[model samples]
Target: MIADEIREQIDAIGIERGRPLLISDADEVLFAFMAGLESYLQGEGLSFDFSSFAITGNVKDADGMALDREAVRSHLGVFFERHTEALDPVEHAAETLAELSKEAQIIVLSNIPLAQRGARARALARHGMDYPLIANEGAKGPAVRLLHDRAAAPAVFIDDIPHNHASVRDHAEDVHRLHFVADTRLARLIPQAEHCHARADTWLEARPIIERHLFGG
Candidate 1:
């Protein structure tokens, strides 16, 4: 759900009434998160085993021992803290959003820690995505719902996580959801989320769908 302060942030965004809305996830969808994490893990003498969609269970030490959830979380914390401002963007993600922003009020609804929100925004701005960002903590359903309600327009939600799609569907039944995994390697391992309207592996394939959904053909 959303905390009071986070709710305030979402409300503070200047969403034009009747303008289309695009709510996007930062990592994996906009930034090359998994790739950056894998490289960081290598530096820490650990490796990311892309066996499944789970990050915690897939990380292994040099001895090939799986890291516990807490350890994995710690690594992720350090990874984001140290590398948030430097991670590369997914191909064409910024360009596509910029094009979409001509008609849509865009907001990055990433699951990053609130403390790193400014760093993430600065990094995104560096890549030409200067939209307002909401650093969310838990399920994105309620936040997506709030954004949708405020915009009062056809909204599109792009994310790589299936659970977030389900959460948005549950909280905001009308928001169009597209499951987008920009990393080809990660896309090969994940199935299309049932709750999502479509699965787009790259921004190339996703842009048209969002345009068609928000602006119509």
Candidate 2:
């Protein structure tokens, strides 16, 4: 399932020689995204409509008028531009990821835009995390596959979205998939995913599973 250009990209990164641990998702996985977004919306007298999983159609003003797609995009661009460097890490994420790095080559493969890459890296570094960060633009499946093919087996995949978990599961069944739900309220809104090997509410809950899988019980 890996393509030639992607293979070249992975080869360039040199994932083949080490045990890779892909700790990912910048928003809800590493930082408190839902709260930040809700705070942003409230300032605009807007709130999540709770009608769907996506943000574009779900964000609505107090009068219940949802922002148009372009407006939503514009708002997001502004939001990330200002707050990318200020986002707080998910409680316990830095320490957990730090501990895991002792045994595996940890890299963050995120869907964050290229424009925000440096700020995101700075944000993570400020939180005591200093790992390689890959800012991707499309469905994460292709990147995950590229990593899987070029790296050693038994890779670990962590993301806040179920679809992402499914994407990795479909692409590389051997890769360990963890569903990390950060915002308790929105977490409750998302149903349990059968494809995800584990569902984690906090980095603490995910720590042992990762350690056990990597270090062996």
Candidate 3:
């Protein structure tokens, strides 16, 4: 179960008034996570075993033995502590989010450790793309539900995780779900989704779909 403190913090950051066109997700969706994580691990004498899809126990050192789940989690905590501020946004992400904010109430819904939210938001703001960022924990369905309640209708959820996308599909039947995989390597691994309204690898490619669905362009 997610802690009340974190949920309250997330709720405080969500879009509260009027119908919203919420566009969110932080790692991989907005800022690169896999690449940054890999680099951080390498600096710590650890590394990803392949370019394949997996994290935690799947990652390993050069010898090919898995890093074990606890070590992986510890590494991630340290990495976020040191490097969350260094995350670089995907190309055109700032402009796209800013533009979308003008047309609709843009709120960022992200499932990251609560400790990293402040640094993440500050980093995003430093890049000129700050918006209301939620530091959600666990499955995103409940968080999406909260957004749905606030926005009423015309909510659009964008994320890179298949599970998170599925969560939204289950909770918000009317919301438009966009599966956005910005990393070239991970994009290929994202399975085809019948529930997804659109699958995009770049903001440039997705702008048309977002404009059409959100604004009837």
Candidate 4:
């Protein structure tokens, strides 16, 4: 399932080869996605409940009622379309990744719609994260596996979603998983996944851990 998706995207963008691959997620891990989404929602006269980890059920109206799943999905599309290029980078993400790139091949694996790929790439590059960006959908296990196959061991995976971490854990067991969420408020709301090597809210904390895991420092 993910092989076909990976083949399609990799064929389009082409992959770079290097030792010790770092497959990372853009939202939450590198960019402040939930924070941007919340601000976008506020502009639309909506806001998140922040009480729940999931977005679909947590997005609320002025009357404090959750929007239907379809509505939330539609709003997400609009949010990305309007704000993807301008979303702020998570603290220390650009600097840490720039440093880490010297030691490992850094590839951003984001679960964003394919249409926003160019915009996202441009945005990341503008923020000094000019690494390869792969826009994918659904579970990231197969994609991570394929990426790992291209580079030397040990592959590292970083994402905010537990399900994505679980996917890598199941399909690419050797890949080190780092569960990261940039927003402090939302970070506290999320529970750490058992499959992850470490759960971090900032790149400052995660950089040392990842460096140690991959470089044996």
Question: Candidate 2's C-alpha lDDT?
Answer: 0.77
State residue 89's C-alpha deviation in candidate 2, in Å. 0.8
Q: What lDDT does the true structure give each of the candidates? A: 0.91, 0.77, 0.78, 0.87
Off by over 4 Å in 2: 1-13, 50-52
Best by TM-score: 1
By lDDT: ranked, best first: 1, 4, 3, 2
Which lDDT tens digits does candidate 2 get at residues 112-134? 76788889989888999887777
Please provide, for model 4 over 1-217, each residue's C-alpha lDDT reduced to its tens digit, 9 standing for 90 to 100. Answer: 6657566776664556547778899998888888899899999999899897889889999999999999999999998898999999998999999999887888899989889989999999999999888888899998888888767577789999999988998888989899998888888887898789888888888988889877888
With a 3 Å backbone cut-off (N, CA, C), the pairs that clash in candidate 2 are: none
Best-to-worst TM-score order? 1, 4, 3, 2
Error of 4 at 88 (Å): 0.4
* Number of backbone collisions per candidate: 0, 0, 0, 0
lDDT of 2 at 146: 71
Q: Show the lowest summed lDDT stretch of 10 residues, model 2.
A: 1-10
Clash pairs for candidate 3: none
lDDT of 3 at 27: 85
Model 1 off-target regions past 4 Å? none
- Candidate 3 lDDT, 42-153, residue by residue in tens: 8877768655556866678778888888988888889889999998888899888888777788777777778888998898898877787888777677777767776765
| lDDT: the better of candidates 1 and 4 | 1
lDDT of 1 by residue, 22-73 (tens): 9999999999998999899999999988889879789999899999999998
